[model samples]
Target: MDAINLVSARELARRNGLSFPNESPEYRQARDELLAEEIELRRHIERVAEQRRALPPGGQVRKDYRFQGPDGEVTLRDLFADKSTLVIYSYMYGPQRERPCPMCTSMLSAFDGEVPDICQQVAFAVVARSPIERLLAFKKERGWHHLPLYSDTTDEFSRDYHAIGPDGGDGAAYNVFTIKDGVIRHFWNPEMGFATADPGQDPRGAPDFMPLWTVLDTTPDGRPPSWYPSLTYGSGP
Candidate 1:
């Protein structure tokens, strides 16, 4: 049996919580099953992460663009920070959009403090179409001192990677790459709940990386479809 058998999404949502659909009995049942599945899923995530680390760093992605740094402007090639593996998190900040992506921000909240340890092994950075000045200002506003933000304002790197939604539109993503012989290649790119929807089971496993799942653990009901409001500006979950 699932861990949360006594509650329903409707009941969960009643008290400032958003969860399974109130009209669908099946959605509620599936939501309950997800609780136990999530536990086993976390172990699976550990294995997949191990697999990602085992992949002898495939492909060579070579593209050049300019970026803004703490000191001044820099180039895309400089983003490697001398590491073999470069992880690029496509931030949702864009020219048309006014606010940073609440989801991306939540995923990053954990990494913000652990970046020092991560930088020692694998290099990571955040890329966005937003101007360097604008991105930096928001970083300050959010107190994100650990991340290295970059701009792809002049190049099609974001489009090439499908990081953005449309031409001059908006989207966000998590893309990883490997550089070899002055060329970089795509390795892994994971999207929210996308792996589970795959047919080949290539997604392999699941985890509570999504904030909704974590919040659901505490309540009898699960999470809501409503936007994930920012915790950076607000208090508590």
Candidate 2:
């Protein structure tokens, strides 16, 4: 849709007749105004996604990185499977840590349910710098049946993809790759990080992927400043 030809968000919001049982005039007025902004926010999100889809082909894969999957070993190209596009999420789980990153695990918990749907379009996999057995054990513990877990035992892929920091610590990373004409190439990844973060805000990618934050954003309280997810909550997994 062309923005130039679209109706104004304010006009659309004003035309909206949605009302609650006990909403006052003041509440309705403010809600309509907020609705207009929400409409614009939706459009901006689509605009950004369109821009991303229009990005030119990215760099080619330099090394033949290997990973240990449930079945056996696999290479980067093999990750694509039968699809042309592949999505790899590098979680913060390494040999040194007794548990996986709470944030990453929280995000993946949501993703586990969506993997089946996501894989219908593009291949998706989760890679971590832990042994295959350890990764699978955690998967079983979390009851994530659909998420494809792999171990980056050699750390080659993690090191090249920024999952392994210069300090040798594990970091969360999301990357996309595409295969064309028998050649695999990088697609896109969130480039914003600590260096690019706005003052007083933690570094985050546009259209945040975490559903936890997205849901919280709709509430009056929003996401708390210091609050974070724990591996287990109230003695429950």
Candidate 3:
């Protein structure tokens, strides 16, 4: 048989209706397109990121919502960790939920060391509507200390950013903002546009954080149309 190299086993698996073992000419061609697709996707994603960067300053934030730190009495501005750009991932550990969202916990688990790396460049944090003690308890339970954690217990900040919707619903979102010259301006954020609503919340889109694709590159099976687990203190879970 003629030798063919493929770019991605996943694509090869997709194109051939079965898994492609090792790189073949067919695999190579598929891999090339896969590479091209990645670049295109990167550019496409970056275009959206640029849109976030381009948002005009809305003005100074009207409210100074409170959050808790080890010390206490911190405001929204304080959460920035002294970076001009601040990213807050409003987490789903709310007063009503029985547990912190596993997926959100998974994404946040990556932020451990990533916090310091980005903190050197930008401020980053995770906030939840749950009380400070409850949020911290979950933080401890999850072993997530690499990133700064806060509690938007009062509901002011989440409400202003549209991070939280109707009451009796899940709370939290991925929102990025800027504070300059003492004014707060919205920047970027993510949402479940079409994720199916669990019970009470509006129908939202599926949670899409791409880890599966990156992980599957290693062995025979690769990622099976799934998300990848996060890095661990040792090996991943």
- Evaluated against the true structure, the overall lDDT of model 1 is 0.69
Give the lowest summed-lDDT range of ten residues in model 2: 198-207
Task: Give candidate 3 regions above 4 Å deviation.
Answer: 1-22, 195-237
> Over the stretch 1-237, how does candidate 3's per-residue lDDT look in tens digits?
112443443454346543467768887666666766765565557666676567776456677678876578798788775788888887877777787776677767766757778888888888887778887777787787786777776777777776666665665577777878777777665655545457554333333443433455456876444443433436434
Q: What would the per-residue lDDT of candidate 1 be over residues 79-185, giving only the tens digit for each residue?
A: 78799777887778777778777877777766677789989988888888888899888878778779877887764877877776646676666777777777877
Candidate 2 per-residue lDDT, tens place, 106-197, comes to: 99999999999999999999999999999999999999989999999899899888898879999899999999998888999998789999
Go through the candidates in order and give each one's C-alpha lDDT.
0.69, 0.93, 0.67
Error of 2 at 228 (Å): 0.2
TM-scores of all candidate predictions against the true structure: 0.67, 0.98, 0.71
Output the TM-score of candidate 3: 0.71
The TM-score measured for candidate 1 stands at 0.67
Q: Please count the clashing residue pairs in each candidate, in the order shown.
A: 8, 0, 17
